[model samples]
Target: MNIELHPRLAADCHRLGQVPEGLVLLQRNASLPWFLLVPATPREQLHELDPELRHAVVERWNRLAAWVARRFDCTRVNVAAIGNVVPQLHLHVVGRRHDDPLWPGVPWGQTLPARAYSEATLASFQTELASALDLTPAPR
Candidate 1:
């Protein structure tokens, strides 16, 4: 299936790899470990999906959440599917810490300047994540 990511998402993230149900993307911001899972389906809401597909997606979400929490040593992991901006069926898995820039606030609409990931850092992370999740790396 040819899954096209929303322009906004494509602009802001690094294509990591594909899982059984969807693509995984790493948000460009290095300050926080934010990941996105865009399921390959036309359905916009999680509840709209049939049981099997929904279960597959949720399983991926749980795996990504656990990985993010452990990798970032996060105080908390925020997972949501607020598609008001992009209207795509993408799940956000953000790692948060008490000392993080957004602290008590949500990452949405925040003006915190994105700390771009260096080439080595991004590549290393992509490799590690792909290995950890058994993902097929996105094409170069």
Candidate 2:
């Protein structure tokens, strides 16, 4: 079944690529290194997915976490699925360093405005992430 992404999420994030688990990989348009794994299912939370799909999500999470740590030299990997604004089944994978703006604090609910990556920088990052994660472009 094909699922649709929410308009807000679509607008706020870039379609980095897609994972084998039928989930789309999105890069948040913020200064910090952030990504989102969104299952192409019409569910609001992880529990709503079938057992097999749930297992896939966990596997993807593990793979993504490891990749983020290695690629970014991040001190921490923050992954969560709290859909306060966009109530869709998606996971946020953030690469955080000790000296980051929100260091020792959560990135969520940070009052600071989003510092978007430059167009060229964003393109370069998308290339790097796609290569590292072995991600395919999401279907239009």
Candidate 3:
């Protein structure tokens, strides 16, 4: 099945590529080492997926979080799928450090501007993330 990404995601994230299970992994533009795991299926909630697909998504989420923790050396990793505004079924895996701008609070409601990556930095990050994920670039 062909899976189309949500336009909002495309706008706000840099596509790191797709995993074998069809999760189109994305790196958010923010500087928090945040990534989004989006199932290609056009669903608004995880419960709507078939058992096998749902399990795969959860497994991928867990793996991504662990990888982020080790790679970023962050104090903690936060994972969530709150679709209040976008209403799309996507999981966010974020690496959090105690000294971060919103240290004791969640990253979602912060008012600070997102940190932007330079073109070179973004390219380097994409390379590292794709290598870690062992994923091939998906057709944009």
TM-score of each: 0.94, 0.83, 0.84
Tell me how candidate 2 scores on lDDT: 0.75
Residue 61 displacement in candidate 3 (angstroms)? 1.1
Candidate 3 Cα deviation (angstroms), residue 31: 2.7
**Model 1, stretches more than 4 Å misplaced?**
none
lDDT of 1: 0.89
| Candidate 2 global Cα RMSD | 2.5
Highest lDDT against the true fold, candidate: 1
**Candidate 3 residue spans exceeding 4 A from truth:** 23-28, 138-140
Can you write out model 1's per-residue Cα lDDT over 1-140, one digit (the tens) per residue?
A: 47998999999999988888989998888888899999999999999999999999999899999998998999999999999999989999999999999988998878776698887877777788787777887765
Go through the candidates in order and give each one's C-alpha lDDT.
0.89, 0.75, 0.76
Q: Residue 135 in candidate 2 has what lDDT?
A: 72
Q: Give per-residue lDDT, candidate 2, residue 42.
A: 76
What C-alpha RMSD separates each model from the true structure?
1.2, 2.5, 2.3
Q: Per-residue error at 20 for model 2, in Å?
A: 2.6
Number of backbone collisions per candidate, in order?
0, 0, 0
